[model samples]
Target: MTHVPSAAPFDPQTATIAIVTFNRSNLLTRLLTSIGEMDPKPGRIVIIDNASTDDTAEVVESFRDAVAPADIVYRRMETNTGGSGGFSEGMRVAYELGSEWIWLMDDDVEVLPDGLAKMGKWAPRFKSIQGRRYDYDGSAFYWQYRVAEPLGIPIPFAPAEFDASGYKAMNSGCFEGMFIHRDIVQQIGLPDPRFFIYWDDQMYGWLASRKTSSVIVDEFVLRRTREIKQWDMGIRHMNASSNAYRYYIMRNRAYIKKYYRELGVYRPVPFALGTTLTFGKELIRLVFVERTVRGTSNLFRGLRDGRKIARDASWQPMPPLEAATTTGR
Candidate 1:
């Protein structure tokens, strides 16, 4: 794919917002409404329906003529490609349609009025302060994924002091409210389709850090609509704990290790061992603690499958050719 230069100067009207939705029609409608209320509204809006069996298409169609300042375009995928695939398709469409920036959001995330504006302000600054070849420096970096504990439940991990300088190694961020420059997308290409469901954001952020600088804006906060409930092991526990999560965690981590290795960054053997132990702990938690039969089975299957992929010598890191050149300016 050819890298498209920034068509015109940076204007909110030229920024395209791409939202990927599954079966959450109601939540998607609210998110769309929030986008419509932005002060300097996005130029275009593209909604990719990931073969949702719900009323997602109808909800989008209802707002087609109603959303102001932003022209709405909807693409319905024939099959569910999970979050990674859906967003990849949405972003690709946005780039092809000549968007200067692509605002990627989850179906349930509600964007505050100032959300885009804040990103618009900080994105350029973040990209301008250079570090290494792939290192970006900026304020307001995003937090890794966090689940909301119920009223009585205690949060597990304490909020760690985010070392902005350590972003290259941390590779932590979420796509729920990520604002990405079109040029970066062109150069980085799309999110890994093999990821299919989970860890796509981490992988993309990892790639982004390598190409340019980025930081999470402190004042810019996007509210997550859905709360993380307690882990239930009964209904195919592995889907969440083992199958999807484990496979990507292992496969992608290996991919990252190999990538850095090629860059002449020597990874410690202990780090690899620690990562394996971490996965094993998660597996034990699902089987012994959570005691979910389905989760155990999924973990077993994921390990079996992931191990096979990890051993394959044909695995290769994705090139950064499709990355877009324009930062935010």
Candidate 2:
């Protein structure tokens, strides 16, 4: 069971915007600008830099000077920690800094000027609230997933389902534009940084959903500035062609398996079959349709290596939040 502050009022001032950024200084600047334009502005902003060689530090310092009144703390990591590590550190810092609510987003996703105010309206209703997102072209970005009828592994949702209203239970989540309360952070701890990249956010979402009420407010919208490179697979949008992304996507099955087992929903044969079917389709597309053998080997290697990663009992979850980090600029 999770702790729910039943009658507590949600204070917008208690919100801290936790942003994880890499090399995209321009995108980060744009996001900070959006924050500057907020009607009810964010009280605090914690940026976790993933060790970018670019002028990420300069951008943060510039924003600190530009966005007066909003206290912005930027921490540049000693190494290039992936999204998982950056988010883990950012969430930890936000909670420790006494933020009742943590508004999480990647560097690429730009929050609408009104997005924070909109989500704040329903902050008192749910333990965890997920905001909606749009692609660059104003098209509906469907990061939400449809859990299998029996509620096991979540699959990509239908495009038509994007317009559905009324808050509903979500099986997964994207940090793309998620609003997380501190209670979930305290109870669930940080996202497993071991995931190192993809699917970690959804795993955290699954963990939070199991413990408390989590919902997506259809009215609140956050637009993603990242370009969509997905290949249309008739039934779903599969990865187009990225050697770098494929490695992490396939390698992180170990974390997903652990995620399911922790939730007591691990159906070995069924899960394996479901995964095989899903990946098999992509494998076929990679070899035949796209005719790209570049990342196919990674897919095979990831599947093979993930089995080992899942079986490692010694591996543990992310450590508890600690002291403040160095101001890296």
Candidate 3:
């Protein structure tokens, strides 16, 4: 695996915090407040506003000096590009700004006081690192994940995967607290904005692992501040997803297949089995956990759309960062 030379030391002054936010201005304020409390704040922040109709711009202005001397670049989108697009643009802006590390997160999570410091400890060794997180109730979030290579899908969080190393090698990534070195970004390019929501981070991280070992360090760095209904799944709790999100979860598999195909690892049988299992899990979530089947129709619709999307000869995967152009849209 390619290691970033020791000469390129990890420094907060060389890092940029990238946030993708939507209509939740209140949550954005809380997040910015937490960032202001960082002992050593990142050198820059790039806020990608996803065409929020709310007072998101006002909220950002209120914290203009939250981290003084660290410029905050707020770019508003003409349309809501969803989480995938926002993070894509966020990373692009930070990279163009010449940040050595780009830390990406959603606005709903609050950074722990020593989050940056903890992540910094591992930066000298790892090019792609993920920090630990807490759920709304202060329970540890299950994050350790591996990809099911034959199926080209990620296995569910496996807490046991973490051990004495204080970190575990991982092929999957979560955007909420994903700390990535710019070198990995240069190779994998940006997260595919065409994803619009689901599975983008996992694919991006997998690409990073191809260039270097990606890992999740066992250090609590952030806590989810938002509360939502969840069902305990023994190892972890599953949060209820929206109908649109459910559709994306299924439809986005096409992109996953496309990625695996490009890698020459795509398998039809295993992928089919994986898709069936995914559909079954969603059905259980909707019927047993959510106690509603109202969104069941979306599952079929998404599957159909995904197949059509897979056959589209025009669709292409994301290019490397050097070849990518940020539209700022």
Query: Judged by TM-score, which candidate is best?
Result: 3
Model 3, 273: alpha-carbon shift in Å?
A: 1.0
Q: lDDT (0-100) at residue 13 of candidate 3? A: 86
Error in Å for residue 162 of model 3: 3.3
Kindly report which residue stretches of model 2 are placed more than 4 angstroms away from their true locations once superposed: 1-6, 149-152, 158-165, 232-241, 284-291, 318-329
Question: Whole-model lDDT, candidate 3?
Answer: 0.86
Q: Pick the candidate with the highest lDDT.
A: 3
Candidate 2 residue-wise lDDT at 255: 73
Instruction: Give the alpha-carbon lDDT of every model.
Output: 0.61, 0.74, 0.86
The TM-score of predicted model 1 comes to 0.74
* Per-residue alpha-carbon lDDT of candidate 3 for residues 1-329, written as tens digits (9 for 90 to 100): 65555456678888899999999999999899999999788988899999999999998998988777667899999999999999999999999888888899999999988899999999988989999889999988886468877766668755544678898888888899889988789888889999999888888888888888888888999999999788998787777888988898899889999988888888999998888888888888887678898898888888989999899988777887674343222
Show the lowest summed lDDT stretch of 10 residues, model 3: 320-329
Q: What's the true lDDT of residue 203 in model 3?
A: 83
RMSD to native, candidate 1: 8.8
Residue pairs with backbone atoms closer than 3 Å in model 2 (clashes): none
Error of 2 at 182 (Å): 0.6
Q: Write the per-residue lDDT of candidate 1 for residues 1-329, one digit (tens) a residue.
A: 12233334457776777899989998898888877777777888889999999988889888876677588989999999888888888888888777777778887766767766766655544531111110012222224323221111112343534455332222334567666776677677777666676656765765675566545544443565554333433321222344556555555544444555555663456545645665675676666644665554554555566557667787766555453343222
How many backbone clashes can be found in candidate 3? Answer: 0
Worst 10-residue lDDT window for candidate 2 reads: 320-329
